[model samples]
Target: MGSLWSQFSTPNPMFTEDDVAPQDSKVFRITGGYSGIGFELAKMLYRKKGRVYIAGRSDQKGQQGIKDIQHSASAEAFKPKEAKLHVLWNNVGVCQPPVGSASKQVIELQLATNCLGPFLFIRYQLLDHAH
Candidate 1:
């Protein structure tokens, strides 16, 4: 009952973009950032001077998102390979894929997108950045 009531309650956010410190040297990677909430977050980070990378399955959409973010923030692009990631947002997800749909590795499409993909990305990032 409390959970249902909270859903309708207009509560103020405890933290917002205004609370974030400048991210002039931070690096961020957001999956599924070509659209929706991820896109907005990328924009916010970019506006705060963070180096943002938007990743998606569709290269075209990702490029468009980058362009839009750059236009909005009037920021220049930096080479992502030169910096280690300060944050990785595993925001990519899929819902209710058709039955029997499989990823390239033969796992269910939903599982591949929501679980395995993030897991693998985290692992790779950790290993790559390990000194």
Candidate 2:
């Protein structure tokens, strides 16, 4: 619990951008990787040669994040193949519309987006990336 709280704090003591280096041939899929901490982490991965996949619901925001990473990565010396950004369109909404206000389809979509998406991403994506 304490550790979890620290993650929300400023200058979170989790993973730092400097902790990992260019992976070159590796692919990374960050579930909420299009903004905030995810965006910053993606930048770090980009610098380290990791092929980053900014997985999020907002296509526009995710593309913008990719552009930001590309712009920063361009300034650094990197190989051609490592320059492209891959985006996985995974919707991850926190909640559905209040109670009976939403249709069954909407409720299901919300549940899938918020819960199933992250779970599948973590289970399958991480397993796939395992060496």
Candidate 3:
């Protein structure tokens, strides 16, 4: 038997817009993707023809995950969308002391990356960029 990691090392599968087309009634999720339950959830959604976007905190990892999905789709004889799958995952957060970092005195890194970064991404990227 293959190691558990090896067994799960396979990337999530992707489907074409036609095969897994978004019908204007799909839901999107964020955070906790690229591993664990989140990965499985994304896989299932993709398989069901939902417009699934995997968001996280690492660009390289996010891109790699997208590649894995494409590879899986190709291997499975499906035409995955080359540009349809959008990735909102990014690490704009900064390190700060535990608890109430946004209160009183805020660490610039923590505030900018953690609080403001995501806020901007959501407002500009997700909301404004919605198609």
Q: Count the backbone clashes (under 3 Å) in each candidate.
A: 0, 3, 3
In model 1, residue pairs whose N, Cα or C atoms come closer than 3 Å (at least 3 residues apart or on different chains), thus clashing, are none
lDDT per residue for candidate 3 within 1-131, as digits (tens), equals 45577677865546543465442335445454566666666665555555566777678877776676555543232333333434444433446556655533454556756677678678876676555
Q: Residue 87 of model 2: what lDDT?
A: 45
Please give, for residues 23-124, the per-residue lDDT of candidate 2 as tens digits.
776756676777877788778877887777777768999888888888888534334343333544343455646555533455466566677767777677
For candidate 3, which ten residues in a row score worst on lDDT?
74-83
Residue 9 lDDT, candidate 3, scale 0-100: 85
- Decide which is better by TM-score, 1 or 2: 1
Error of 1 at 12 (Å): 3.7
Report how far residue 35 has shifted in candidate 2, in Å: 1.0
Candidate 2 RMSD to the real structure: 6.9
Question: Against the hidden true structure, what lDDT does model 3 obtain?
Answer: 0.57
For 57-128, candidate 1 gives per-residue lDDT tens digits of: 799998899888888996668575744778889888888989999999999999999999998877885565
Better of 1 and 3 by TM-score: 1
Off by over 4 Å in 1: 1-9, 96-101, 122-131
